[model samples]
Target: MRGIIDLNSDELPKIQDKNGALKRPPAGKAAVENLKIDAAILRQSLVAQAGAEIIIYKDPTEAVSTGVLGDVVMMSKQSYFETFEAAPFALVADGGEVTVTPLPINRAAIHVDATGGLQTASGIYGLRFEFSRATLKSYPSIEDAIMHAVVQGLARTGDAVLTAGIMAATPAAFSLAAAAAAGVRMSELRGLVGTAGHGAAIDNNGVLRAAGIAAELSPDLSATIVGSFARSAVMIRSDVEVVVDRTNIDGSLAVTAWAGLQALLPDTTRFWTVAA
Candidate 1:
């Protein structure tokens, strides 16, 4: 076996620049052992994505009482006490009807503790919730074309054909066989949901079919499938932005990694602005 005993370390430069400016290089053992950041590299570190700007404070009691802060806020604000069925998610609208606001001291003769009051007035607050990995690209203006290929290729060869067909459809559809298969093999995925959440399926095909109710899949559950597979499949909410994480600032909301990417078409679809 070839060994590293005689390799020359002097030829290796501290950093290398490709197309951009000379930037900070990754830290090495020497710098890490010394508990030091290479100042030379720190100065040129590149930012990945812009951070959100909303900040929100929740009632600790409510946060602990309910499994979700977003749901608690919705129930308290909307005046509903029913248990949530679907997983909780939130959206920080841009100062509109559903704008974020501080909790009032009193509501319907009920007094809210000052400590747990909404921080909208005192400061900014943002909403947060969990998102499926399949929907991660829903917000960004990128095509799943590349990701679709990578994910499909990594799966069975038939998955590549299924993915291509789905992507081509107006509202993509996955056959029952495909959906069941994806759900089963979901454990083996690396580049998509499985990798992001560690064996989490994120229910990509199932969720997408559920969301495509009015389009790709017939809303009438009785609709028959004449495609490659038999049996109609269930649908998930595609356009629904599951609030994963958020911070609110003075009424403005900063959302965290909301899952799912909106469709790439731009020809006046109803789900366009809503998803955007």
Candidate 2:
């Protein structure tokens, strides 16, 4: 005859103090003797299941200028990450639908490209999607798997666009105003005649339009800067003369300018000459 040992409340004191001062265990037997206590399960079994994620938001600011005086337009964006699942796994899932709302762009709004299969905004910078799970494939159905991938792709794509957009606006230092007269003081060379720079002036005629360029700096000075006029008609300040006889005797060229002046030009020209 097979018999099982029972460890009931009688054997494993379920009640508290005689006066019931101590709390009582669940009003049930302790455990079944036939059932073994699995130490491996206590060690390996995931106590909880959770999916943690992080997201970032980037927004580029626009530039507004009036001639030579203008703000160094840059893409300004709100950048931050949202993490899901902290304590109880329910926190992340509690929010039914995760909506990614793109910032409004009256001109060319940033949109998602599903066919692109998760590319970074501007196609540069580091934007990636990470999934963590006890067992990778836990989705109940194929549709669910695709849906998850889509969501992650959208999230990563949005982050890439925003991050790249904002980074694209990071302020840059200016270089030598090429058209400035050779002997002119770098300080006096305020507005540049280059395609870039805050006060950098360019009066390219209908060429930009003809080339399909919008013919204007982006709101944040972050859009494509047209070099159409760079080759043909780009002329520097009248005082600045192009020198055919000039040659770098030192076999090197370095720029020296104030921070303010640097801010007005391209970053490639921020370096200055060490006082020889």
Count of backbone clashes, every candidate in sequence: 42, 15
lDDT tens digits by residue: candidate 2, 64-151: 4555766554434332221111122223467587555443221222222332211232232222223333223452242223323332
Error of 1 at 185 (Å): 1.9
The superposed Cα distance between candidate 1 and the true structure at residue 83, in angstroms, equals: 47
Candidate 1 regions exceeding 4 Å error are: 1-12, 16-23, 26-179, 182-184, 190-276
Relative to the true structure, how large is the alpha-carbon lDDT of every model?
A: 0.23, 0.24
lDDT of 1 by residue, 76-188 (tens): 33121111112324685788565555442221111224453422212111223334434444534222222222222212222222222223443323333443543323221
Candidate topping TM-score:
2
- Candidate 1: Cα lDDT at 101: 51
